[model samples]
Target: MLYRTLGGTGIEVSAYCLGTMMFGSVGNPDHAESVRVIHAALDAGINFVDTADMYSAGESETIVGKALKGRRDDVVLATKVHFPMGEGPNRGGNSRRWIVKEVEESLRRLGTDWIDLYQVHRPDHTTDIEETLSALTDLVRAGKVRAFGCSTFPAEEIVESHVVAERRGLGRFRTEQPPYSILARGIERAVLPTCRRYGMGVLTWSPLASGFLTGKYRKGGAIDLTSGR
Candidate 1:
């Protein structure tokens, strides 16, 4: 498979990163089967793996961890934060406190010393961008994470983050993982352009619209997702 250097970071990731949103209890509950998919993806030359801590309340990362037990070094692993990990008021978000703590949780679950790319899963209206950058910068400096990025941020937020990171001596967001699908083309006019302006890499999520395009979600039927909250 083809590989490309992620933005300015020297880490080379596969052209096709295996997304693990559906590998856990929220989507698929079969841990053994999920492990098979992950191994097969690695065997097929997909060296990049993207997941999130909130996925199935962290079960997805566990499966990924088990799958990469022996071959972890061959993958460019990425995961996200910002969603609530528990009922605690401060259990999640883009705040420095949460980022600093949640990253360790992510590291522990993935069974890796460093993450290839750690991303802010979504914009946190309550938290300052500088706070997030400051925390992530600490991770990079400590070698706990190679780089950090953001996902689903507005075009303006992306620009502001770059400015703030530069001004405050924090690590800049080297990538953007926005949700881009045929049903969602709004990013093309703005988000993509903003990322390009800052030389940030683009790793889109839900290019298939969470299986909406696969005829899996039947018209007029109830939604597939049932919130635990």
Candidate 2:
């Protein structure tokens, strides 16, 4: 497991982050088996785990939180917000109110006091990027989160947020997570380049094209991932 520093944060994470998107009802619901996978990944030198609150309506985080019990110090834990956890309009967005409330919920579900990297699941176009950064900066100051970032953000938004951080003296985003796979190479055209330019660590999703490169399915073959477990 090759570890790379997360930009200027002085934190090292494994190249292959264990993604818990398939945990809970969407995949395996057995807590024992889910925990085993996490344990095996850790044993196999996976020091990073990425999950999101929207995954299976936060069930993934619950499983991951239980899996990391008694060994939280050994891994760099990350999770995302900014997605609807409920039907209400106020349930999601990068607003300071939601961010503050959501992180606390995330931490509770993860069984951890602080998240290593708290990420915005998506750009909340309805809210100001400056407001998001400012809220995240406060979380860092309060020690509720160590570092923060964004996922699936456009190149322009990433640059704009950085400028806002600089101008407001807020905590800058230390990482940028995007969708990068053989099939989806769009990030390479702009987003990846901007992250490199800004010295932000890039952690991408869909590296296997949703198992397309795994060779488990034939070309033009249909896969039923409905029963993910």
Candidate 3:
């Protein structure tokens, strides 16, 4: 696999990242098989792995932890927060309280001391971006996370985050995870350009349009709803 530099961070990652969202009970329930697939991807020169805490309620992270037991340092491990992990009032979102607590939980599940790339899973309109950045800045300073980023944010939100980070002198997100595929090119108009302007790496998800490009889903026929695709 080809490697590319993520924005200006100097960290090299595989152009072909192995996503682990379907590794747990959400998609594949076989633990051994999941580990084998992860190892296979690693062997095939995939150095980037992305996951989230909400994936199968954190089971995906646990499975990834088990798979990366001895070769953890060889991969660029990334994961996200800001999703509902429980039924509590303060269980999720970009609030400092939830971020702080969820990071620990994610670390425990991933069995890692520091995440290579920690990301906010989505935009949290309720919490100020400053609050999220401040908490993330503390994490960077404390060595809990190497770098951080955001996902599924609008162009304006991305710009606002950059401006706030500059004014506040906090650690800024180095990457953006957007949904980009053959069918979804809306980000190209503004979000991609903004990310380029701010020197943020772009890690897109559902590049196959949730399996729409696989020829399995027709215009008026059977569609694969598995994995929420």
Candidate 4:
């Protein structure tokens, strides 16, 4: 598998990252089978594994932790935050409180001393971009997170984040995780360019348009809403 540096962080990662959103009860509930899938991806040279704290209500992280038992150091482990983990007001968002607390939970679930890349799952309009950046900066300094980035943020927000980081003298976002596929090319217009200008690495999602381009679901074919991504 081909490898590339993640943003300007100097850490190389495989071109294909294993996304574990469907590995838990929300999709595949079998722990042993999920572990096997993760192993298969690693064996295939996929050194980047991406999971989220909120995926499968944290069960996905648990399974990933199990899968990476002896192979953690060889992989560029990534996970996300900024989603509600429980039914509460302070359980989520991009605020410092949530990010600082949530990182510990993610580390525990992933069974890792430090995360290669810790990303915010989505933009939280309610929280100031500086607040989020400051918190992430602390994580990097604390040696809990190697780098931090945002996911699914628009071009404007990405720029705003960089500006805030520069003004505040904090760590800037090193990467971006956006949705990009043949069917969804919106990022190409501005988001991609913005990331390029900022020298940020990019990891795209839904490359198959959530399986639409897989040919398994045709234009006129009926799709089962209950299954598939």
Candidate 5:
């Protein structure tokens, strides 16, 4: 598979990252089959695997942990934070308290000592960007996370994060994960250029427009709305 450097981190990743959002009960309930799918992707030269703690209430990470057994060294694993994992107010967000606590939970679920990329799933308007960056900076220093980034953040927020990082002398976000596909190219306008200006890597989700452009839902064709995305 083709490879490219992940932003300024210099870590090489495959062109297509295997997104395991549907591995758990929310989508695919069979753990064995999910593991097999992960293995197949790895065997196909997909060195990057992305998951989120909020996906299937952390079950996806558990399945990923099972699949990456004895093969962790060959992969660049990424997982996201900033979503509510359970009941309670402090259970989620970009605050340092939540970030610090969630990273450990993610590590445990993944059965790995360190994560290649730990991303903030979305911006938390309530929390200061500096606070979030500070927490991630601490994770990198503590050897829990290799690098960190943001997901689905606007161009302005991305710039604000970099500014905060620079002013506060904290490690800046090395990448940005936004939704991009043939049907959804909004990021190309400003978010893409903003990332480029800061030399940040871009990882796009929903490349197939959540399967809408996968030829499964065509014009004048019967659509199965009940099917899983």
Candidate 6:
């Protein structure tokens, strides 16, 4: 796998980051099998791993944590927050209260003292971007997270967040994770160029278009739900 520096941060990561969204009950449901797959990817030279606290309600992080027991230093670990973790309304969003607690939980589950990249899973329309940046800045200063970023944000929101970070003197998000594939080209219109202009590293997801590129989903044949029916 080719490695590239994420934006100007100087941290090199594999071009194909091993995504662990499928490691937990949401996908594999088997802890041992998930660990084996993670190890296999690591053995194949995949030095980046991306996961989220909300994946399988946090089971994915637990699985990835165990997988990285002796090898956390070798891989660039990235994870996201700002997703609903429970029934309470406060359990979600990018507010300072949630961001502080969520990141700690994420670190606990990953069994690491610091995350290479800590990201807001998505933009919260309700919370002020300044609030989110402020909380993230604290995390970076405290060494809980090396860098901060976001995922699935609209171009305008991305720009706005940068502006807010600058105005408030907070550490800015250095990367953007947008869903990209041959079929979904919407981000190409603005998000990609915007991130490029801001010097933000862009890590795309669903490169296979949620299994559309695998040629498994036919018009009339039997369908497999496990592979995205």
> Which model, 2 or 5, shows the larger TM-score?
5
What would the TM-scores of all predictions be? 0.94, 0.96, 0.97, 0.97, 0.97, 0.96
lDDT tens digits by residue: candidate 3, 132-169 = 99999999899999999999999999999999999999
State the displacement of the C-alpha of residue 229, model 2, in Å, after optimal TM-score superposition: 10
User: Per-residue lDDT of 72-169 in model 2, one digit per residue for the tens?
Assistant: 99999999999898888899999999999999999999999999999998999899998999999999999999999999999999999999998999
Model 5, 133: alpha-carbon shift in Å?
A: 0.3
For each candidate, the alpha-carbon lDDT, in order, equals 0.91, 0.91, 0.93, 0.94, 0.94, 0.92
TM-score, predicted candidate 5 vs. hidden true structure: 0.97
lDDT of 2: 0.91
Per-residue alpha-carbon lDDT of model 6 for 87-174, expressed as tens digits? 9979989999999999989999999999999999988989889889999999999999999999999999999988988888898989
**1-229 in candidate 1: lDDT tens per residue?**
8999898899899999999888788889999999999999999999999999999899999999999999998889999999999898999889988998888898899998999899999999998888889889999999999999999999999999999988988899999998898998989999999998998999988888777888777778888475211
Worst 10 residues of 5 by lDDT: 220-229
Per residue, candidate 5 scores C-alpha lDDT tens digits across 89-126 of 99999999999999999999999999999999999999
Looking at model 4, which ten-residue stretch has the lowest summed lDDT? 210-219
**What's model 4's lDDT at 39?**
97
Instruction: Give the higher-TM-score candidate: 3 or 4.
Output: 4
lDDT of 6 at 184: 93
Lowest lDDT 10-residue stretch of candidate 3: 220-229
Sort order, TM-score high to low: 4, 5, 3, 6, 2, 1
Clashing residue pairs for model 5: none
Flag the better candidate by lDDT, 3 or 5. 5
Clashes in candidate 1: how many? Answer: 0
